[model samples]
Target: MQRNQIIRTRLGWTLLDGVERLVSALWPARFKGSVGRVLLLPAVLLIGILVIGLGYMIEYSFHELDLSTYRLKDEYSLVNYAVIADRPVYMRVLNRTLLAALIVSVTTVFLAFPYAYMLVRTRSALTRKFLLIALFLPFFIGQVVRAYGWLIILGKQGLINSLLEGLGLPTLNLIYNYPSVIFGLIQYMLPFAILLIVPAVAAISEDVELASEGLGANWISTFRYIVLPLARPGLIGAFVVVFTLTLTDFAMPEILGGGTTDFIASAIYDSFFQLSNAGLGAALSMILVMIGSVIVAAIFYLAGTGTLGVREQSR
Candidate 1:
């Protein structure tokens, strides 16, 4: 027993000594904040690059597209912006994208809340393992592949239709519609909402919940009064993230919209690729950035900026 204890003591000391040496070699413990900032230098550089690229796009958006040469005009004008403002098509696409994003965010949150709550509140190890697998399994599947899977399931002669035909029923027009796009988006966004919300749900103390129950508070009251408010930040975060993602999504609408239903992303792609109008695409890209920024800013403004974990308030 003594020999075993001695060996264990030596092992612990060795691990501690190794950790100390590694820390000394990597960064000074005395200047933790400075070391952290140094570690984030690469991220700062990347942000700088993004800012520079946006500046170039903003410059391009002010110029006209020369269709003959397929290049931007040397003289600056707001012709591209004017086109966007004058055309009802652009506004319609933007409005549709925004509405779809809002719907997807809300639907995902509603469906995810109960699932996330169950995942966090369950006591069974088997339940946790199963829930985790369900949560993370889709991550292995690419977004485009998931969208295509829906195609096979919801197509005119796909799985559902095949089954329906076998039963002597007519096939429904499931794909290439607004509802199909929204449904595909909801399925794609559900896992993200649950992942974002699980941490907040888990953060609630079971002891506090029990105490609330003891105080004559029913489950509904306890959740409404105690749990809902605490989970608001995470929910807001998930909503904003999902909103931005859906607003800027390209694959779902392109693959499923079936030529008629076009989101702003598809609009931009058509501008850039189909028409070979880089200037018009740049203008649309700028508008998208501005709209997305307004949404994120609105979320931060209402939620007090903690929702995104931004430390701007410390300044």
Candidate 2:
């Protein structure tokens, strides 16, 4: 009985292999190279839908909104954009958004670098596991939940203030301000920055650092000259990602800013929902997209878009 079972199992394996080869032979040669492209169809369709929506936005942006009927005018013009240009308030919001994005991106990168380096270079298994858990734990929580958590910690009667009061110190007001908003954004973006940097840091060979050190270079010198230059792609990638995310962030500024420090996204929200001016809102949305695109384009031009581990071929 055992000999018969072994023979049957071997025969079944041979038949399965034959069927697989037969199927492969029947598949057209022209279509074999397109398997990856076929997998990308879903992404292409998503982008197509987004482009169609953007087209509608562009059409709406050219028309003026009639406040009386709350309808868009049939006549197309640059009135919506003109309004943005003429109003100092719009420019101020844009400026604030840009400044906040710059601050958050720079700060996040500065803070994430050491964490990422340690995560990749650490020898202790326990330390690496701790770092990974800390890095990814926030991702399990939604951004809104985290923002609200910050409120619980930073609010007037929140934990920090409660602790201060217990210690016989004056309770401080910490939430609902520009600095608080920036602080929230930095905390939210740190994990992303570190994630982007880890792969780059990991890609760096330890032998290169050892070679530098053997050549009478100290650890600091090796890090500055060898490690940093090699990790440039990851650093640039993290900066761009955090900057773009911070620029368009709506919740942090809304929740932590206390309606006083509004970003561009807030202004856009007000135009559409509060004022019921779709044309103006569409215009604002387009402007925001353009601003983000231009900044990203400039970064790609300067940094060469090698952020995805693609290195230029050396001569």
Candidate 3:
């Protein structure tokens, strides 16, 4: 017994020493705020680049465009904005884009939440591995390839239509519509949502969940009161990612939206590249940047305030 105790003590000390060394190796050498600023210099420069680009766009948006020469005038004018406001078509497209983004974010959160919960909470090792691979598989595939795949799947007389025809049912029109756009956006955005939720869900200790169950709480109550709160951060992260992706989606809409549809990204592309209306394009690009900024701010506020979901760590 004495020998066994000695062995255990040695093992513990060795493990602790190894952990100390690992921690020393992993931790930043210094965490002084000034030192931290040095680390952030690269990030700062990247942000500066983005800000300067967007600033130029904003400046150009306010400049008068010489119609004949397609050159910008020095004078400031709200004519670009006025043009945007006067057109009901652009307003309608903007509203639809907002709605589409909201719907995609909400759907992705709901679908990925349950999947992430299952992945982390389930005991089956194979199941966990399977889900992890599936969640990340789309990342390996190029975005254009994924969009093209969707185009094939949703195209008229494609897989779904062929299946329906084989079963003697009428071929449904799935392509070139809102449904196609939503379907493509959801697939494109799901991986991000899943990745964000998995970490938060994994952070939830099993003991807390068991304690809730032991206290006479049903599965639904346990999830509502325990699991959901702990996974709030992940949900917030996922929502922000999915929402931003949806807002900036250009490929899916272009491939599946047919000719009639017009997303803000597509409109900007048309203005800048197609029509050579750089000023209008710049204005539209600025609008996109502003929309992205508003969303990022809102997500930060919601996550910081713990309004979006339950905070698991504090509990």
Top lDDT hit: 2
Write the residue-wise lDDT of candidate 2 on 1-315 in tens digits: 999999999999999999988978987677889889989999999999999999999999999998788899999999999999999999999999999999999999999999999999999999999999999999999888998999999999999999999999999979888999999999999999999999899989999899999999999999999999889999999999999999999999998888989999999999999999999999999999999999999998888867656777322
- Candidate 1 lDDT for residue 9: 100
Q: How far off is residue 122 in model 2, in Å?
A: 0.6
Ranking by lDDT: 2, 1, 3
CA-lDDT, candidates in order: 0.90, 0.94, 0.84
Ranking by TM-score: 2, 1, 3
Candidate 2 runs further than 4 Å off: 1-26, 312-315
Q: Write one digit per residue (lDDT tens) for candidate 1, span 40-67.
A: 9999999999999999989988999887
Cα lDDT tens digits for candidate 3, 10-87? 999999999988876776556434676789899999999998987888898997678888888878998888877888
Q: What is the TM-score of each candidate against the true structure?
A: 0.89, 0.92, 0.84
Check candidate 2 and list the clashing pairs.
none
Q: For model 3, which pairs clash?
A: 229-310, 230-312
